[model samples]
Target: MTSFAPDSIVLNRKLPLWYQVSQSLRASILGRSPQDSLRLPTEEQLAGHYGVSVLTMRQALKELEDEGLITRHRRRGTFIEPSAQRGAPVRLLGSVDAIVAQQSGMTTELLDYGTVAVPSGLAGHFPQHAEVATYHRLRSEEKTGEPTNHARNYVRPDLAERIDPADLIRWPMTKVLRDVVGASISRITDTVEARLADPETARLLQVPLLSPILHYTGVTYDEEGQALDVAVIHYRGDRFSFTVTLDAH
Candidate 1:
């Protein structure tokens, strides 16, 4: 119970402090070294880190437990839940590689694939010649037999044409980019939003209508910073989570 938390955190008045504390701890657990079994700082240590009392830290830990992020034993310290043992920490640096390089044994199932018009607002994300030479893919994943992400991806026409649609099912997008287009990825930018799944999207993800989900849209750029592709993915809220680390300076 005397161990201090790993980092210092700042809280804003915009949201509940306990929730923010839970989120910070959740990120730490998910971003932990995969080789090590999940363990946590004791409540007293966490209280010291956040400059809060043991009771406040306990309330924050309770939030994580409710989210299936942690479990406590009577004599032993809190441990991360075993069922949620996914290692795919989506770091912004070397993103797709980080996402694909994981021990969770993620397999893809392609649902739909074909050329499509680039959506209107995405003009800046594509070159002028790419009026319609884009492709979209809808696929789901089997992560240890649990359906995890209902992903939708898009590739620039040239990149899309370089590989067979069938290959999309067998390979991760990073592989296709390397073997097919052979372009050096320079940057990735994305936005995450929450929405209620509609009937069709629900059917795709196998979740119920109106269930909460995370929707992501992003653009990838090549070494020259030229936009290479655009992607949209929907993750099953119950099975997937996104974590990002921030700095004050």
Candidate 2:
């Protein structure tokens, strides 16, 4: 059996043991090089390394198998799937920086852009302007070519004027606001909900109509508490996951 460092994965009693183990295993599998073993250590070895029960370790392995990252065999052993794709689920931990950090190396495609009267539903997000610049965008994994999210962004008129369409295609909206428009972002408020995809969203994301999706609405604000931009992203439910961290204070 291949040997593994016992201290490689540190467990947080506060979180689910199986989840922690699975995440660590996933990272290891995804980070492996060609020279690394294609097969994983036995469940008993992994359980001993992580100081978890065999049942908990099996649960962790099951999670990877469900993600198509690994396959288990009764006669042989557990091996990483050859067709596994890059960019495992997007993990969000209650911060804009964290979100941006996770999106590194992804490719962006700007589908459409135009200026129009701000929708009444988004009026509160841009109270000072009746009209705003809008963009329709889709981002996907560069390696696997799998669609991750479909997003529509509305920018304040002033900031939007300073932004270049090229920049929107090259960088994240928040990055464009900060680097191109020179807007100071003080905070970001994200509200997430579960909803079924509409026809347009289903078409763009390549999913069946009415398929469950994660609806994310994020409002970016300046130090003065004025909203500068609003982003609505429809994430494929199976392709993305959010990890939320909370403190009791």
Best by TM-score: 2
lDDT string, candidate 2, 29-91, tens digits? 654544556778899999988899999999989988987888999979998886555537755
Score each candidate by Cα lDDT.
Answer: 0.64, 0.79
| Residue 155 of model 2, lDDT score | 88
Instruction: Please write out the lDDT profile of model 1 over residues 1-249, one tens digit for every residue.
Output: 233234445665444566556656665565344454566777887888877778878888997787676898887999877554453333332235343333124556667677667777776777565454443444433334556666666677777767676676766666577666687877778788998898877887788999998887877788988877776777777765666645333
Residue 120 error, candidate 2, Å: 1.1
RMSD to the true structure for each prediction, in A, is 9.0, 7.3
State candidate 2's TM-score.
Answer: 0.67
Full-model lDDT, candidate 2 = 0.79
> Runs in model 2 with CA error above 4 Å?
1-87
lDDT of 2 at 246: 56
